[model samples]
Target chain A: MLTILLQHTVFGIVTGSILLLATIGFSMIYTTKRFLCISHGELLTIGAYTTYIFHVFLGWNLLYSGVIGVVITSLVGLAIARGLYEPMERHGPLVLLFTSVGVTFCLHGILEFIAGPSIRSFRTPILPSIRVGGIPLITMNEIVIISIAMGSIVFLHVVLTRTRIGKAFRAMASNVDLAMARGIDTARISMFVWIYASAMAAVAGILLALVTSVNPDLGWTQILIILAAAILGGLGSIYGVMIGAILLGVVMDVGVIFFPSGYRAAIAFALMIIVLLVKPKGIFGGE
Target chain B: MFRRTRIVRRVLVVGLSLALLAGLSVGVARAEEVRFGVLTSLSGPLGTEGKPCFETIQWTVEEINKFGGPLGMPIKLFVADTATDVERGITGARKLITMDRVINIIGPSSSIVVAIMKFCADNEVPIISHWSGSTRLTTSGGEYQFRTCPDDYFEGEVAARFMWDEGFRKAAVITLDTEDTISISDALKKRFAAMGGEVVVDEMVVGGQTTYRTAARKVLAKRPDVLFPAIDLDTLKIVYRELYEMGITFTVVLASNAVQQATMDIVGADILEGVYGEKPANALGSPGYAIFEQKYREHMEDGMVGWFTPNMYDAVNLMALAVEVAGEATGKGISENIRKVANSPGIKVYSYAEGLAHLLRGHEINYEGASGSCDFDEFGNVLGYARIQQAKGGQWVDIKFYSSEDLAEAIR
Candidate 1:
């Protein structure tokens, strides 16, 4: 029982970290943009597929492709914001909302067209498992995930709290008109936010690929977990999103040790619903 | 804004015209060309399976065309990617049947087979599934749906029987959460329990889940004598690796068809050593398999390794045979003729080339394919024998054969 509990916790934390990466970006985008970026999953797919292409196909170093994939996908996000989202910004938020969905469908089709519809596995490096006192520790990929997730949270915290542009970004998120009145360039802040959120999503996608195999639709599936986490963390609160992500991950994985594995996904969705009923604002929302 | 509106109008007009042109072409195009739709997850996680099916079908179509088509008419292969989406499966099937006007459809491999089977049966379109092995496909009332691969029930029963023969009593089942998997696991559990074999634990894993430690720990806690994990290749490899790392060992680990050569390749030999299960016979085991394997390896750049590739190759050939035997590519005629060509006795059709020759020489060709014999029962299912193999010395060594009859008895 002790071993099982510990194992479950360890595994849960690894999953939580990946979920945190996805949700943090999702939460940030939602907070500033004020609408669901349905194409966020495609951003993840871009990151994963980019990593697969760069690292696996071109035989580039894993670490190099990991960084490059994140960078490329961040650029993709910026492009989408400027080219697709910006056009509809003057129309209405709803127009941008529907356009995001259209972008998602189009991206999905384009990926299918290029990748030739086959599963591609990355030539994953064999990292040794850390063991202590006879208990095997998780893989280095998982440890990297936990570290990156923590790093992201801390970095975001510093950026939001200390930086001038970060304050302007926050002001814009709270009220675009008010921020513009205060001489903050709302458009610039929106672009920065889009780049930042997408960069985070790319990092998350790369980390997910590191831990698991990369596929075109990987981002679409991971987005569900991210959505659950972000919703549980009150949608827009970065700190809350992180905590909610960990909690959602734990509940879905660790909470259902005895249950059949199929129920794991169902549990994640069920937790979101249950939390929504009890604490609609989420655990960290009151802050 | 005016320019944008102009572009939108042009797109609408062009889209409408294309639709109209396609509709008109459908009426004018003669029914001489044998049209078959290959529906599989060509663009999603399961696209690996779909890719080979497409390639095999295309390759078969090319060969048939070179020989002057199925019945002196060129074969037209219409391919669609379902991406493993259930809804997309239906849409692809409908398009293949209604728009493409294909007499037969060959896939979106696996569960998509069962999904499209009902629709095909209703519409009277003969669907020869290349990979999916759902019980629903062969259970009953699926006259139009034909499967070339061994059924899932056969897989489970074969796995269970192998364990039973090995004298394993207590078993734990770890299967995927999907309905297709759960049903097969349930069937295995019921069968194992009926044999007085104790199923100490039954666990499920969601598809696309990366980590398996929690479930592995829980399953290990049960301490069953044997672990019967029925899942896809990707998930199975992850679980096996986790179990190895955790230092967990059972007297036996029984896997289904998913734990074949490709899976064994991923996790390496050390983890899979001594793991026993029922899967399609290795391509090395049969002369027909060797010939196809050699040709595929030589000619194709992106060909799939192991079982399903040849199975799909045979399925495409079987479709052509069905068409030839029926004397026309009508759904009703083709579906009925499948059994006639598949189970024809004393007929020696080793490959598509051979099958084409036999067709020309006025002989019924029994497709003893690379995957297995394409012998369909009254249920339109071929009960192919599952090969029992153990991972040893970095390779799968076939120990013996577990016939479908043995499975039917042992599972019950």
Candidate 2:
């Protein structure tokens, strides 16, 4: 009984940590940009596919593949900004959000065109499990995932709390036009945010690939979990998002021990509906 | 002035001749390669199902080419990945029609088949779906759309009858509300109810749910004789954990055939001790089972064995046969010849190599496959048996086989 509990918890944590990183990307994008990027899911998928191409096809090490994945996806984010967000910057959130939708479709089309729309994963074996103190530990990939999630979150916390650029970002998030008038380089900062979000998405995608299979829509599906987390955390509040992500993961996974198995998918949506009904601003929405 | 004028005339004549020759060559090469559009999810969530099908097409083309090509002319496959999105599926169909100008297409896997079927019918391209089992795709009575896999309505009837025969009078259904799953669930529920069996519980899980606790409780409350699930691996893991720990034993637990090896590993085989489901590829079968087991190990790393692989392999061989029977590589000719090659009366052949040998002998051949017999009804649905596989001692062991004919009679 104890062993099963430990196993489920470990699995939940590993899975949750990967989701946390992906939600961070959504948090950063929503906070700074204040636009609904429905296609943010595909960016993570691009990262996963990039990892597959570099690591599996070309025989690059996993670490190097991750680097390639993040770098390439960051550039894709920049391109999305330039092509979709940049042109619509002066427009309202609705217009900008719609443009992101268009960008998502175009990118999805290109990927389908080139990759031939098939699920692909490394032919290399899954990392073998490790046991410690009579509890079977997860794979090395999962260990790396947890570490990366913690490291990225801590790093983001530091960057946000202790840096001048972070202050400028907060200022922009507070009021974009006001920050622009105050002589902050708003465009450059927004570009940096895009890169940062894209990089976070890549990390999430890579970790997810390590944990499970890398389908063409794997990252996109992960985005749904991210949305649930972000919305639970108050949409733009990074701290709230992280807490929400972990909690959401636990509810879906850990909470299942006492609940009916088929109702698990309903829990997340149900929570969303409840949160909206009770606290429309989310747990950490605008002050 | 005379030299310059003569040079200009010479250059103009040479350029015009080169242009004309290039155009003529383009037209001739186009004639040499007959195009067949293949619609499958090369991307998206359901991409795994389409990957092996893609390989089967490749293998078929390669083997066919070794025998001096289909219809003594090279066959070119124009593939567009649908990404498993319905809108993208429609776009893929358009691309195949307008860009490839193909006569027939192979897939888009599931309900996406319905969308592509509409387009293929409109464009007059005969389509033989390799994996999608939605009855609506065939029952719509469309002229151009044909499937190589059994419909869920038929498969569901077989499943319900299996439970009935196994002496389980009370059943519980846990299903996802997706178009495909819902279709199978609804059919199963109606059939089970009509079979004088009590459907003690009916629970619908939202698509893509990873947990199954609340729904599991609902199913447990019914105290069903059997629990039938329409779900995938992720949800199955949660279901197994809750069911076993809660001490819910049953006469049998049954589900749709999508549980991969990974799910078993996650929850242990003890929990799935009596679970049963339907599958197309049973290692117990002949011809390609050995080869499939070997190649599946090599190519599909994901540890999930989908029922679609054998049908995928058979679809390719059928296409190769159509090409031979048509004596031409055009779409119209191939479509006209599909039934001849698939359902013909003769000594049967299995592999592409054997198929080629028979083609050489100018002999009509039936292709018996690893999945089952490759007999197609008028609707192009594969006529075969659904084998019942039970999870015993950590493997999906086959306990019984239900033929379509037998199932049809039982359902009636």
User: Model 2: per-residue lDDT, tens digit, B1-412?
Assistant: 9999999999999999999999899878877876778888665555545676687677667666777677677668898877666887788888888877876888666677766666677676777776677756545633566666777777678778788888999998888655666777777787888888999888777644433555765676678898888765544544555455445667554555354443444445666676787654332356655555555556655544455776776676677677777887656676677777666696677766676688779888787765566677666676555777877888877778776666666534
lDDT of 1 by residue, B1-412 (tens): 9999999999999999999999789755656577777776675545655666677677768877888877878888787778777888889898988888878887655567766777887778888776677766656634787777777777667667667777988898888765457656876787778778999877777777767776677667788788888776667657766776666668545555455555554565665677776675433467677777877776578554645778788788888877888898778888888777777674767776787787778887777777777778777777666777788876677787865555565433
How well does candidate 2 reproduce the true complex, by DockQ? 0.20
lDDT of 1 by residue, A214-280 (tens): 6667787776777788888887677888998898877877767766666677888888888888888
For model 2, what is the alpha-carbon lDDT of residue B228?
82
Instruction: After the best TM-score superposition of candidate 1, give how far the Cα of residue B179 lies from its true spot, in angstroms.
Output: 5.4
- lDDT score, residue B161, model 1? 67
Write down the worst ten-residue block by lDDT for model 1 chain A: A119-128
Q: What lDDT, from 0 to 1, does candidate 2 have?
A: 0.71
TM-score of chain B of each: 0.82, 0.81
Q: Which candidate is the best by DockQ?
A: 1
